[model samples]
Target: MNAGAINETDICESGSQAPAATQFHDDAPAVAWLREAGLRPTRQRVSLAELLFDKGDRHVTAEILHSEVLEAGVGLSLATVYNTLNQFTRAGLLRRIGPTGSRSFFDTNTSVHPHFYLIGEDTLIDVPEPLVLEQMPNALPGHEIARLDIIIHICRKSRDA
Candidate 1:
């Protein structure tokens, strides 16, 4: 497997650019999830989970993910892809980011922390973990913050004016 490539199995083709199909291994979470979640281990879901787990510490847009699946010739529909993503998100396996620019990205890591977005470059950087630990939000009289998420958007300065 290439440095960033996740081993995914597909009925599509053998020569896709992503990587080769990988068999079940002790460490692959896909295999474990199948066993733990009572899932039947369908080829599509397994392939998706493996990619999610193996991609470690990376954010990916669904389009990019679908392209990879299609490149592998998995023949999965976009709706199915979205459905599976929503299922995983509900299962606490993924974090769904709302509209960021024109694209939405999925963060595989569940551990909470702030994020910085460089709008000009469309780059996302995870804020250092320590910052989250030190700051606590003040609560209102009637309601408290159920979740604290910090996303900072950034942009580069243009030379004009």
Candidate 2:
């Protein structure tokens, strides 16, 4: 995996066993953003929001975020992180992408776009340009296509040509 890439599936599945308790300062911008999204700006929510949005656009899993929160000296449970992320997703503040049933990634950029998932590196990268599909498959009788999610998986080449 690349530097800073989180490949620990165990941690992702099971949140931190124990987290230290620490005080968190209020983040004005995060509070405002949360309120605008119709979500209450609780201390935990504000703290997580600040960390998640401080960096531009990026992808993260619950475990990755939980680890970051701990590193920041914040006292938050894995469950809390999961709940907050789900709330953000429901409010359209984030987009959830599940490459497989067992793993999911939260994208800070809500805009519609494709992504490239590095197989061994366990990282997700933006595709840069929009993809144009030449044809669309017909939806079932009364069903309609809500949206399209395309993720291209890439891996390293072998040592031998």
Candidate 3:
């Protein structure tokens, strides 16, 4: 082996390749989640929702969601996920994030609160109300105060740190 050869162990420690895909369970509980949210139960809707929320509160873009769907062997088109997200957003089951552009994200937490984006690791964490919002302005002049949102982007130090 060359003295500077790449460390394969650093990439795949198990010494075996990970499966390229996974399949999810499509049973009654998934249906109940949809209905509990007052969303009309449909196979496609339930399947994707189960994938999105089953792992707990997380943010995902349509592309990420679509790829996850494919990884799960759902065999649905990306367009379907996009459309479903739009509908779900309208239905108040999911929140449409990213006013930035195509790089949108779907958040499973519907509650009124803020989020923390770990920019370095590309992860999002829900910041509870007390940590930030508790200190917010209780009253805004001439503003009806429909909602309040705060996004804190974080980054970690590289090896230099």
Each candidate's lDDT (Cα)? Answer: 0.61, 0.78, 0.66
What is the per-residue lDDT of model 1 for residues 11-49, given as tens digits with 9 covering 90 to 100?
Answer: 122221222244454556687885464344556668777
* CA RMSD of all predictions: 11.8, 9.6, 16.7
Best by TM-score: 2
Candidate 3 yields a Cα-based lDDT of: 0.66
The C-alpha TM-scores of every prediction are 0.67, 0.80, 0.66
Q: Using TM-score as the measure, what is the rank order of every candidate, best first? A: 2, 1, 3
Tell me how far the alpha carbon of residue 30 in candidate 2 is from the true structure, in angstroms, after superposition: 1.0
- Sequence-dependent TM-score of model 2: 0.80
| Winner of 1 and 3 under lDDT | 3
What does candidate 2's lDDT look like per residue over 1-161, in tens digits?
A: 01113221222233322222443346589988877887777788888999999999999999999999999999999999998898788777888888767888999987667899988988888997767666667669986555556799988999995
lDDT order of candidates, top first: 2, 3, 1
Off by over 4 Å in 2: 1-27
Best model number under lDDT: 2
